[model samples]
Target: MTKISTFQVEDANTQIVDWLKIYAENAKVNGFVIGISGGVDSAVTSTLCAQTGLQVLCVEMPIHQAESHVTRGREHIDQLKIRYTNVNSIQADLTSVFDTFKSVVPHTSDILKVNLALANTRARLRMTTLYYFAGIQGLLVAGTGNKVEDFGVGFYTKYGDGGVDVSPIADLMKSEVFLLGKYLKVPESILTAAPTDGLFGDDRTDEDQLGASYDELEWAMLQDESKKSVEDFSGREKIVFEIYKRLNFVNRHKMIAIPVCKIKK
Candidate 1:
């Protein structure tokens, strides 16, 4: 990956801000509303949206969230508020809502399936909350997903965090997002913290779930782009490459459009 100090990061920062401003202006919307997950992706994206000098509402929708995640999210929002007059934040604790939802839903016998469904449920609930705020406030929902997560592994819930009006950092890799986050003066806590979806309400990092770090995944993505076969590698490299391939295959549906059965015209 290229270093952070390159001119590309600066250009990307300016371009995204300009793109967002034009998008809002064209759509006749007020500004952007984004969820802050105490992660670098959200922090960087929200900051870029704020730089547009448009109203940027940073929403923290915590559903049985970890203490560190909550703290980092609050701190990032606070900093953005102090730095940008157009930036404001609100916290919507959804613990009760999630609990109520679980109570109403039928239980599954498989623990893994149950846990995965509940995790996705939490994300969808947050997405609904963001849209509620957007509809009332006339703002667009800005997504925090980066390149590796959004396209490489598809490490997001469909119609959940993946459903958004716009994605500000979707083109940049996780490493590049950190570089942009650093340039934007994002908090050290967030810049240093391991990346996690925070949807599972646990400290398990993305690596823990994906079986590969963002850096490793990034390399695998590049190798995949070159059309390298699994037979070309050995040991841990092979293992990581395989992990990347498996996720990309499994989540390809999330990355593509909903299939529409076409009536032959």
Candidate 2:
């Protein structure tokens, strides 16, 4: 497996923080509001926003979230509060909201599709909640997706986690996010925890769903940049390259802007 490249941690942190501050200032927004999942991406994003010294509201929207996920999320919030005077937090337990949503929707015979739709629903619900807070607080909704998830695999839900005013860490790969996480002194629990979206309300991890680890995906992404083909690889490398290509192709729509039909005079 190819090693993921690293960068100078201090420079990245300073650059991202500076960019975030300038963006918010130019937009005439008060600050940034982000959903704080227990994952490294959210943790790192929130920390970067907090470094801007703007009003960073870390929100926890739990729809039957796993215990570990909830705990780490709260832990990061607490740590950020102590470290940054601009940080604040609140929790919106959406378990009942989700249950009510399920009750109101009609059931279909496609169990697999139903399950997937429900998972995406959880993400959309959280997105709505984030926007609600943003509306009230005059804050921009900061997205937590990283480069691998946003561009490499298209693993996030469209109009769900994909919904954001700005994405601070979307350009960074998963391994790079972790590097910033360590530099920012993010809590060890979150740093050590397996990366899970917690949308399904179960213990399934991102790797479990994607069929390849982020490290492998990052390597595959680099290889794709070099125009390497699966035929050039063997065994595990071939398997991982194939997985990367499949996800990239299927979710290409998410990576690009929406298409509009042009009118003919």
Candidate 3:
């Protein structure tokens, strides 16, 4: 575990912004498109893209189950004053999409799959919407996954929230993202809000799903750099550890591009 220069907060922020600028220039993207989940990761990503002088198109696609996050999503966009569009993909659309799959195969006790499918559908739909506007507007799809989630546990859905042309904060750890948020001067309330997927019913958080809090995860990831031993193994910690071990396959199969097999003579 290599440690990024903790001394270079300003440098890191500048480098991130500059990298985004280069991508924007090379890709001929006049703006950036992001699915704003009102979560810290998306909030930080969207705000950074907006502040970098790109036309940030923030999309809020709240399912019927997550109608409550709608207001919070809108509030963040409103506060940012970036060009935002709210698109709702509620039960009607989700049910419509899943109808075909369910008809092909019988539903099972895998309620997790059912819930994840609904959630992932919303995310992918938002990505599709972003690309729709991006193509029309000559913009790039900016991904919002951070380092901790990207490396540790593969916490995102494949072809869902995982699609993007460029990720502005993929290198920043969870704690570093918070620091960047402060550097970007994101609103205090959003900065302090609990990180969540907003896919679950009610105000359930990502920490709730992962078992361990992001704060604890961040501490462990950072501290593990030295010859540090894990002191406690909570149920959540075990789950997260398993996810970390499994992320290689998750990313290789899901997030990565497919490899073509060639026949040799």
Candidate 4:
């Protein structure tokens, strides 16, 4: 049997710090802008960016439905002493976007259309706020996606969370991300809590949507080189195959260079 423990966690602290410094110096940025969602990914990214000595402006944009969790997110961010802004993009800009889209996308269940549209609006508005701050403050938008989400499953929205100038941990897997978070001494409450994007109802979370535990997912993804091939498909292999196919299709656009037409001259 292939071992999941073979997935080693290396320290990217020095590299991340140097990268942020070079990016700031090259772009002449005064700081960085990040979205804090009370999740490990953003929290860890914000911390690393802050450690680089760049002024980190963290925005907590929450819907009325997710305010409590956002409140917790805010408290967690405060513990890190990162400069922060609480922008309620959901109830205002997000709601408006949903209403506009629903009027044209064919009448459907308000719950389904409203929820999906609202999620998209939330992502777009958050990016708008990030860029707005970046413009005013001369900051770069730092992305928080880990390797698993960025590569393994295309778990982000285009022009949404995917719209970042730099990704600090894009090469690290989910397990590696937790290791780095622990290495950075991030707070226990934020580190140990369930992973989520806070895009749904109060108790909603990412694992529930994926229909598998993070551990189970990671186990399936940690395929050994020797174990390659459909022959290796065994327990949980079906789950891995389904996930790989779905995310692979969903994120195909993210993996490509922008299409350009070439004319025969």
Candidate 5:
């Protein structure tokens, strides 16, 4: 298995900080707006942005989020010198939109589908909130997705988490993000906290939904890309491979650019 060394982590930190500065200056933006979920990805990304010496607005939008998650998010923000705001509109916004959907589609009966839709709605609401602040402040929204979730398994919401003006950690794998988080001196609570989307109220973790740990998933992804056959993998590796394949197929659309219709010549 490939491992990210300390030197690589430091280099990634430097590059990401440089990218943030260059992108903001070129776009003529005043600062960065990021949604902090208390996850390692957001923690690392926010820290990197803070290190850039640019104004960073860390907004915590919790929709039926666990108290622990919210606490951790607040804690991480406190550790940083950046500006932050807690937009506690989850209950009102999520309920209103969800009820509107139910009222509009009274015939819809699939519980799973409804739940998934509501979860996505929650994400979109957060995205909209971030953009609102960004627009008013002339700041760019910074996405916190890492390489594994953004490209390997495409685990982010379609225009929700995926909707951002800049992505700092999208090129680093999940494991690499953890390494960067440590190097950046992220709060220990946040660095060790289990990653979650905060969309599900019950506090199910990312691994709980993805059916595999980030390490296993990363391994499977690398092995798959290396063209290793299933016959070459052990039983556990095979299971990881299957999970990777299923998630990649299911979330492929999020990983690719939007399709455009071309006119016939």
Candidate 6:
């Protein structure tokens, strides 16, 4: 396992807060907007923004989400005393969109593809909700993704959770984010809660979908090329490394900017 360090929390916090201040000022935005999904990432990100003493709006757009998820989200906002709003248009909005899609393409037989598309739609809807408030208030949409999910595995929806004006914790590993969350005094309930995207209505967790823990994934990501040879790893390590590589390949498009085609003059 990689020797995760706790030394960077203070420095990370200072850098993120400074980045937020400068970005918002330069953009001439009034505040920060974030979709609080009752996960540690959002909790820590929102708290960091609040620490900046900026008007941070934590919006909860629950779409067929579990009651516990909604409760945790609301609790975090109230605990922080940050400005917030709950847009409970989940059932109506999502149902309508799904119904329209079914009506338009009535013969789609691929259940997995359909399910994935709907899930991505949920994230995009939440993104739309965040931007709705951001637009009116002149705030930047703050993304809530850690390094492993955002870059290593690309475990976020493109133009959905990935669509944001500013990313405070994008550079920090999941472990580092937790340390920074503790340093920022984020609520214990939030810090200890299992992380989920809340896109799926069921109780699936981020780890469940990834097939490996964030720590394992991070370790795989940081493994030196000298360690890539099969002889260098144990059987279990090989399995984990394979999983990490597969996920990275599948989601690589999300990490890179769109490719542009230039016509030669």
lDDT of each residue in 131-194, candidate 1, tens digit only: 9999999999999899889999999999999999999899898899988998899999999999
Clashing pairs in 2: none
Sorted on lDDT, best first, the list reads 1, 2, 5, 6, 4, 3
Worst-scoring 10-residue span by lDDT in model 1: 1-10
The C-alpha lDDT values of all candidates are 0.93, 0.93, 0.68, 0.70, 0.82, 0.79
Which portions of model 5 miss their true places by more than 4 Å?
A: 82-107
Estimate the overall C-alpha local distance difference test score of candidate 1.
0.93
The C-alpha TM-scores of every prediction are 0.98, 0.97, 0.78, 0.82, 0.91, 0.89
Candidate 5 structure quality by residue, lDDT tens digits, 139-199: 8999998888988898888889999999999888888888888888888998888888878
Pick the TM-score winner. 1
- In candidate 4, which residue pairs get closer than 3 Å at backbone N, Cα or C atoms, i.e. clash? none
Error of 1 at 105 (Å): 0.7
Ranking by TM-score: 1, 2, 5, 6, 4, 3
Q: Model 4: per-residue lDDT, tens digit, 1-265?
A: 2222322433377678788888888998887888887788887888778877767777766544465566657766777773434221222234455456546765456787767666766677778878887898788999998876776667776788888999998877777677777777777877778887766555767787677666655655565223555456766787665676566568778867789999999
Instruction: Name model 3 segments beyond 4 Å from true.
Output: 1-7, 65-68, 82-106, 219-243, 246-252, 255-259
Model 4 collision count: 0
lDDT of 3 at 187: 64
The better candidate by lDDT, 1 or 3, is 1
User: Over the full model, what C-alpha lDDT does candidate 2 score relative to the true structure?
Assistant: 0.93
What tens-digit string does per-residue lDDT give for candidate 3 at 1-265?
A: 3335546767887787788887798877687878877667877888777757867777765555465456666676777774433222221234344445446755568998877776676667666767776797787888999877776566777777788889888888887788777766666766778888765556778887776776656655564444444344456665554444444345556645587898998
**Error in Å for residue 93 of model 6:** 8.1
User: What RMSD value applies to candidate 2?
Assistant: 1.4
Clashes of 2: 0
Tens digit of per-residue lDDT, candidate 2, span 140-210: 99999998999999999999999999999898888888888998999999999989988887889989999
